[model samples]
Target: MNHNVILTCAVTGAGDTTAKSPHVPVTPKQIADDCIAAARAGASVAHIHVRDPETGTISHSVEHFREVMQRVREADVDIVMNITAGGGGDWIPDAADPTRGGPGSDIQTPRQRHEPVGELLPELCTLDCGSLNFGDMVYVNPADWLREHARLVQAAGVKPELECFDLGHVWFARQLQQEGLIDGDPLYQLCLGIPWGAEADTETLLAMRNRLPHDAHWAAFGIGRHQMPMAAQAVLLGGHARVGLEDNLYLEKGVLATNAQLVEKAASLFENLGARVMTPAETRAHLALRDPNTGHVVEKAIETTAGGAA
Candidate 1:
């Protein structure tokens, strides 16, 4: 288990949850502000997904992404930006014609899915490893498309976080690593408790953790009521943890939560476990990331004096 633990806060997801909870940030400004605040609350990274402001639905517009990026850049926070390339894959099959896509289906080509990452060049971007029945609609990402997406991310110099919803997805992620499409030590985000995905329990988490590459930098997250418990489990199992309104909206039973609140809760869990929460600077060093803004290979440099022992 890696002693150092990194916490990520998903600021605003591309989910239709504006009406479900008031804490879900709607506009770009709100999302950016929430991300900055989450950083202050001890989140080293912030996963972002933009939404349509008026309709309060998910959107993949570059303009929306630009707005969020600009605001975060202008702020004094030092959080790592991780944009989503998992959009444009949701496919709702047509009832009348099984072969055709239904109204909510958002099937897009690999290039289309990665346009935002290419344009923005964020420090990290998510790459869902394979297709799965995401609720009623199937989140489609054929192997060819996934390979293309990974190549684009690697070429752009952005680290790809392989998001695995199930054990089979983990196998595919490993396959990608073996194929050399993903460079450096890979990062995995185990998404648990989502309907039709891996369940949120100790046994399931351990099995998935066991299958991961020994050197893989990984994080796990659970949805709704399992959020905090899964965070603690990840920390105990020597892995990083993620929490935000995107996966869980409730702080407690019948209580709505903000992004900041979720991050704070995770921080407390880290404290209880006797593990220190890493800052963005510390996380950057741990991951050995190059600066996205400057193309500099940033490493933690050791300080030495002229004399060994004054």
Candidate 2:
């Protein structure tokens, strides 16, 4: 295993996991606080997704994003922000009238999906590369829509993290890179253990990693029980790792975990494997990420002096 590795903490996701775990942050303030705690626990990057404060449902509101970003900035944490552009693509077909739109369908144009990213202008954003059966409903993002999103993210000067749920999605990501849609070194997030996407295991991870572009910067994450194991597997395979309550809520078999706990476990796993976890400033330098407001590459010298074992 390599000595240098980056750790990303996904603070909150768009999934409907609030009902299952009370620790999942619903409001913007709670989410921001959770992100700050994760940074303090040794997370270099934070993947954020906002939810409605009143109902705990997933939301793409720019106002929600603005509040979270403002609070995090005020806290003066060095964590890199990575917002989600993967919403507004769910479609639940009408059972009675198959051609008509269903009750739960939340389909929107590519422009709508990217509105939050345009407004927030975070350092990193996700670009789901392909569509698949996301449980019962179809999560739709056709090639044309993805192409448009790629162009938009590039124009906004935000790095796009190619989110690949399956092998085909990896191919599409490479195609987009070759077409000059994504800028700089392409970054990928290999999402495993979903219903209709790739499964979580050693063979699947190895196959997917082998298929990625040689120069690509990539991270892999697994959902539920596979989360910690996948973190160890990813580091052993010479790739980065991501973890949070969004993917798994349990610290043990019956013990619920906070977002910071998950990050701490991931950091410890890296150390157990003889790898040194990089800080946020080190991660920014490693990935060549620039500050969104300043338009300058983030220097490692500006990081806080606090240090601890990963």
Candidate 3:
């Protein structure tokens, strides 16, 4: 079992969970406040997704991202911001015409999906590896578009959190690595327990873990009741943990949870599991991530100095 772990809080996802839970943040200020709260509660990173303040629907506006980033950066606590570039890929076919997009179909060019990440320059952002049957709709992420998106993230000096929902997605992520599109030690988020994707069970998690590159920094999360259990499993298997309203909305059976409460629970659970939950600064050093706010290497520059001294 791994003795050290990094806990990431997926603050707010693009899903329609806002109406279900009052704790889910909607406005830019609310989202930024939740990020700070999660960091103070012991989250090493905040995986963020923005929504329209009025409609509570998903949005890809760069200005919205800017406001959220500004609020987080000016806060006293420090945390790595990880935006979602996986929006604008939903495809719900029309009932009458399969060729025409349906009510929920929201598809955009690779550049359109990447506007926020390109403009805001967060330290980390997610790249959904491939398409999947996301419930009633299809999450459309083609290989060529992914290649183009990877190039955009690479050019912007932002590291991507490779989000794989299945074994095939993992294969494609490895392909991206082979094609020299991903930079440095890639960070992988093995997303489990989504419909028609990978199941939330030990056998499947183990299989996905075994398929990952030996050098990759990875984490796994399960939705609903499987959240905490899978997080504990991830730590035991030498990987990090992710927990929050984005994946699960409960502190217990029939009990709603805030983002901070879930992160706090993860921190406590990981500590008792004989694993040390790493801080944000420690996590950056461990992954050799650069400081997005200052444009400095978090650890590699120090390593280079030490090497020269030797």
Candidate 4:
């Protein structure tokens, strides 16, 4: 097992989980507060997604994103903010007309998907590596779309956390890295345990992990009840862990959890497994992330000196 690791809390997701759990943050302020709470609870990073406050549904509004970013920055916590560039890809075909998008379909151009990330320029952002049968609907991320998205993310100078839902997604991500679309050391988020995707099991995680680029920095997360187990699995396999309401709503069976509660639980698991949860500063250095506050890369020289002194 890796002794030192970066723990990330996916504060909220763009899924239909608002009504399932009251703890899922809907408004910009609520999401920001929970992200700050996650940071206080020992998460080095906060994976953020915005929603329509009144409707309690997924949103891709720039204003909503701006509000969340402002609040989190105002809190002045050291959490590495990771915005979602994986929006506007949900496709639920209409029963009446298959060609026409249904009520829930939220497709967008690559530029529309990258708007918030390009404007806000967080420390990190997600790029869903490929399309898959995401439950009833198809989450469409075609090759051309992914290539354009990767190029946009690179131009923004924001590190893309290549989100791989299956083994083939991992292969495609490696292809992107090979094409020089991603900058710095490529980062990957091995997303497992969703409908029709990679299973949340040791064998599946290992299979996907093995396919990653040799020098890639990666993390893994599982949904629902498998969250903690998959996190432990990831850590044992020498990768990082991700936990929050986005991936799991319950702290335990039938027990609803806040973002901080989930993060605290993940931290305890990491500690018990003999892995040290990294601080935000340390995670920034480890991931080579830019300083969100100043919009500049953290100086390697300064980080090295600080580590030596410590």
Output the TM-score of candidate 2: 0.94
Q: Write the per-residue lDDT of candidate 3 for residues 140-224, one digit (tens) a residue.
A: 9999999999999999988999999998998899899999999988788899999989999999988888888866778899999
Worst 10-residue stretch by lDDT in candidate 1? 301-310
Higher-scoring candidate on TM-score, 2 or 4: 4
Per-residue alpha-carbon lDDT of model 2 for 1-310, expressed as tens digits?
5467788899889788899899999999999999999999999898999999999988989999999988888896778899999998888889999887698788778999899998888889999999999889889999999999999998988889999999899989999999999877788889999998989998998888888776777789999999999888887877888999888889989999999999998888888888878887788877778785687866543222211111
TM-score on alpha carbons, each prediction: 0.95, 0.94, 0.96, 0.95
Writing each residue's lDDT as its tens digit, candidate 4 over 1-310 gives 7777789999889888998999999999999999999989999999999998999888999999999999988995779899999989999999999998998899999999999999999999999999999989999999999999999999999999999999899889989988999887788899989999999999999888777766778899999999999999998988888999998999999899999999898899889988889898888878788987677787533121111000
Q: In model 2, what are the clashing residue pairs, if there are any? A: none
Off by over 4 Å in 1: 300-310
True-vs-predicted CA distance for residue 12, candidate 3, Å: 1.0
Cα error, residue 160 of model 1, in Å, equals 0.3
C-alpha RMSD of each candidate structure in angstroms = 5.7, 4.7, 4.3, 4.1
